[model samples]
Target chain A: MELTRRDAAAALAALGAGGAVGYAAHEWGSGGDDSPDAPDDGLATDEEVRDALVAVAEVVYPSAVSGIAAFVESFLAGRLEREDHGRGVRETVGELDELASEWYDGPVAELDPEDRDRLLREVGADVADENPEGTTAERVRYYVVNELLLALYASPRGGELVGIENPQGHPGGTDTYQRGTP
Target chain B: MSGPATNRARNRAVDRTPVDGADVCVIGAGPAGGLVAARLADAGYDVVVLDAGPRFDPGDRQERMERAIRPAYDRPDVWGVGGERDAHAATGEWFYPLNHARVKGVGGSTLHWQGMVMRLHEADFNSRSERGVGVDWPIDYADLRPYYAEAERELGVAGADDNPFGPPREEPYPMPAFPPSYSDSLFAAACEELGISMHSVGNARNSETYDGRSECVGYGTCQPVCPSGAKYDATVHVERAEQAGATVIDRAPVQYLEHSADAVRAAEYATPDGETHRQEAEAFVVACGGVETPRLLLLSESEEYPGGLANASGLVGKFFMDHLFAGTGGVLDEPTRQNHVGFITSESHQFYDEADAEVGPFKLEFFNYAGPSPVELALTGDDWGDALLERLNAEYGDHVAVGALVEQLPREDSYVALDPERTDHLDSPVPDVHWNVGDRALETIERANQVQEQILDELGAEVTWQAGPDSTGPAYHHMGTTRMGNDPEESVVDPQCRTHDLDNCWIAGSSVFPTGGAMNPTLTIAALALRVAEDIERSL
Candidate 1:
């Protein structure tokens, strides 16, 4: 039948029980959050991406129960390796981490939730202004955030958490679905 | 000298059946062919659609991309016969030669299309009355409005209920337009500030489920193929036709139409394995797109009609048209580019209907996406490495772009003929497309650009760069090769899409577009196909 969050979680659990997962299939923007380039254990296992993810995810989505940082980190790192000629979404992620580090001496996870929220707003503005002399920071941030939004709104688990419907009959419909100010 | 068997003797025949034997034979399977096959089959006709290419799947995107990059875009790959010139071949990501005219298996080129579905403005029909140029259409906007509505429903367009400048319609759109992407939002805000009214673009992309399909995933991969069935493609219609009873013969390249007494009797084709086959029918419909339709007519020349059947007007492949597009981008004060993912969610047609004495009124479609790929972005800007990347990170959020797609009024001089030296598979002549924009076209573009520059300035975007020469590339909206007219002397097909002088022969697709408007062509193509199908059913 149609794939759901429970099925994906069960798949994730099975993979966890079996040790590391392999890059068998990827439903990054939908049903499954499996990374095409990940080691397959679970999510965001890349060190550089983990650090960046910890910084930004903690700021934007700090429910802790949501596990937003780990999920986003895994998604970003996976997409970075495969997209845009392997340079990665490094600049945008790096900007987030550097900002978080500047604001808090310790890891972003150690920051108080209030400060984390404030840091997210601050970093959002910073990344949005990244560069203009060449490609422009606004363009870079747009690309990165757009990818991130896709990961959040398009993935199965993300869809469940956000109350979005299953994209049955066509999995690519999420791209065309009109979203409110979420 | 050459009766049916004698003509058969000239080339080793595949199906040696004489004239008037088969049920239905469809020539070419692009948008029109695909849709016709599906509809006729659904209506209980034993339709046999002949296409030149093989079918494709979305998973084959990489292979498709490789082919596109290595050969298709830069050379004479897809045009069939000699096909059109390679000047406008470099459309990024959506480039594929074999599938250009009539994609092989199912969806046709809708598999690889950007789902823009705009209805032609009212002025599109009566060009002479409005623009003081081009011939007025045999049909008017009112005549086509019902078909437009039907086509929109069938195609599942996502557009606003209000279309102030468009033709009056029966009902509102089935679903609302797609929301504004961040880039679109920025442009909207900027345009609003500039007193330019922006509306969400009417896209063929499904906003909500209508038929048995799902919505779009906003993958930005509108070209090549939509693995997801969110976008409307002709294959979907073709598939529907197959389920109903149409027999699609993939890889059957139609060579020419076989006719007698001005009635199409059969279609000659080369199978994938090189066997020549002829499928005879009581009636023949040629839906081989603009370039191929004309090529087929030219190749099917008989002594009775030396200049080509229905080409007594000498206009079988005359008056080709394409929307010429130019893009200009600048940095706005707001964080516009950071959210490039949904860029192009909205547009402003304010400039489209405004009165202008010299060039007439032209249309403008503002882009909602971040400008270019990283490599392209790098080339556009003078920076590299972390610094360059850093700049991309910052400025992507502040960029707003406006792209203009202007209608190049039809001129008979702009035409597609077979190139003598260039031969393609099946030994067909290459389509020698010779199109040079007239003075009015240039003036139209300049006026649009001037307005866009003003809008960007008003939005406080420091205009950085514009993409185009004094002129721009003829856009992907290819149209009007074998246009329809009231008189047989001036056109290849009649208003019913039946070939003039050839009673049982018919044609379809944008090739039948009498006048190319500034709007995207898919909606119009769909409407025309629907209209032609009705006529065919009536004829039956």
Candidate 2:
């Protein structure tokens, strides 16, 4: 119930961000090339970013959820292609890793599930207001948490999980509309 | 000092080579211009249509639809409506978003319009006699009755004879009506409880493939873009005109009309290649919509008629009018299945012709796309997994909304004139729209909101938003700039839609509307364009 309250507050923050940005629907991770991980300019390598996100997803996602690593990896490929968004995402991941090293004596990917969740809470991401150009916790909520949620809800598979058989942009034909939900 | 004669001399000094001389020259390639061109071409006349915008590829609709669906993409950018070329000045009480409301391409604003079509009631024609407010149209509903039927058939309207308040029609709609959306059915129960009547809305979109286009597959982004070709746009008529031997020159914006005291000799226009050319014709038709039609007339000042081309009465850009939208939305306790349909399937015209009502008429619309989209619900949530699912289910389908188009009376204060300060890409003065919601319109909006609130209350919904008098905005139904009248001293155009001052120039489209009713103007526009085409044929 407490998580639900926090989630509602976070949802409003994410909505604000979503309103400011335009999103397009396409095959996840289909367009971008999969080059080998090459970290540059103090940003995290793609592999390190994927590892850390998967660890975060393990704690953030529900216990029934499966394929957390694969989903995060695929979604990241597409997100990393957009220049400004990709740089912000990389910086957020790098900040998370720094916080992880300082708190848990290692990288975020190497932390236990409970420890990773605790690390997120410790950084005040769960309570801080989400802002793209604010504090580290706000940036984490803006670039990291909202990005994951957007990818999940925008996808057809994730949409079905939330009773959205056919999302707004998808063409589900006239029959789906003519018949009411049973 | 520079005068009309000096401007004419300066224009003549430029390379004004004549091109595409025809029997009739249509200035715009919008619904009115396209319809006129098609009819004149079919009647075996050499017609040439000059459009200010590029001809959009039908195949690129899917990409445009993507732009509309994506939250990050701007709506204006999706239709290519920006840059110096489309700039205009809005020095009104409220900022009039002209560029967002109009598209300048081959199909014009129809390219992005929600395809609702309705006929003006008999009372709408005789507003002066019936309502004691706005002036009566020179021509009545009886005169346009046959043309309305023809326009419906030409535009391929899908509807049912269910609206009791509608004017009498001789023929059924071209196609059967679209079934009511799930949300409309929900509203029906609440409306029935309150003793209000609901009827199917007539749409230009196909119900079951009427004119070579496919039936509605419900892509659901019908306003800004319809990926499927089921929805009708003015491009349909433009293509029909082209097939009937009408030559259409795209990206050709007419700068000014070259004329003497009696008739227009030619239209001087600029192409994409930065060259000016003259289109000489036997008769000239300015089929641009309300705003641009008057702007064009004002821009075409000459030594013969210095005030403006057809401004001997000084009424070219006067009596401007638009319909204002009053909307009320809320969330019901149960699922309404909102956003299932892109367009409205049901509406109420019960209050449209209210007997002896002081306020102007208003038509209620039941919105099918009222709630947040799935993507919107998803992004706004803070929960990642199971908790997020609960929130999405609770919020997605319960939202409902009611909207009304309130009639606006033509006023002296609200008119379109050329802005002295702002110039468009071609260095021509841009249209300055001076508009304000009058006392009658404000009263109508309040009445409409009250009606909507009653419906929402009957539904036992939690009221979230209501657009009151101050919040009500234009429905983008521009009308009554070059209003039609019999007297030459009072109005710009005659009963035949001919400019009172110019012998050979005719005006078509909503600019000639004496009074704007609460219905969509496109069907009436098409009918009047067909009539203009017939008149031009008779004259030649």
Interface RMSD of each: 12.7, 5.8
- Backbone clash pairs for candidate 2 read A11-B380, A11-B381, A11-B382, A21-B72, A22-B71, A22-B72, A23-B72
Q: Fnat per model, in the order given?
A: 0.09, 0.49
lDDT of candidate 2 at residue B521, scale 0 to 100: 96
Model 2, B227-264: lDDT tens digits are: 67788889888999989998888778899999999899
Residue by residue across B1-540, what tens digits does model 1's lDDT show? 123464345435343222234466877666677677777777877777777655443444432332222211322232121233221222222222322433334455565667788888887787777767787788888888998998888888888865556666678887888766645555666677777777777888777776888776544445544544677877777677768876676657777777775787678887645678788876677877666678778878887767666677788878877777766778766554322123246666676766433575566676655443221232233332234445534543455677888878778777767666766666676556666556777777777788778878877788887755364765656678788888877877888788878777888788888888788888888888888888887887
TM-scores for every predicted model: 0.70, 0.82
Q: Report lDDT (CA) for all predictions.
A: 0.59, 0.80
Judge candidate 1 against the unseen true structure and give its global Cα lDDT, from 0 to 1. 0.59
**TM-scores for chain A, candidates in order?**
0.49, 0.72
Query: What stretches of model 2 exceed 4 Å from their correct place?
Result: A1-159, B1-19, B355-357, B377-391
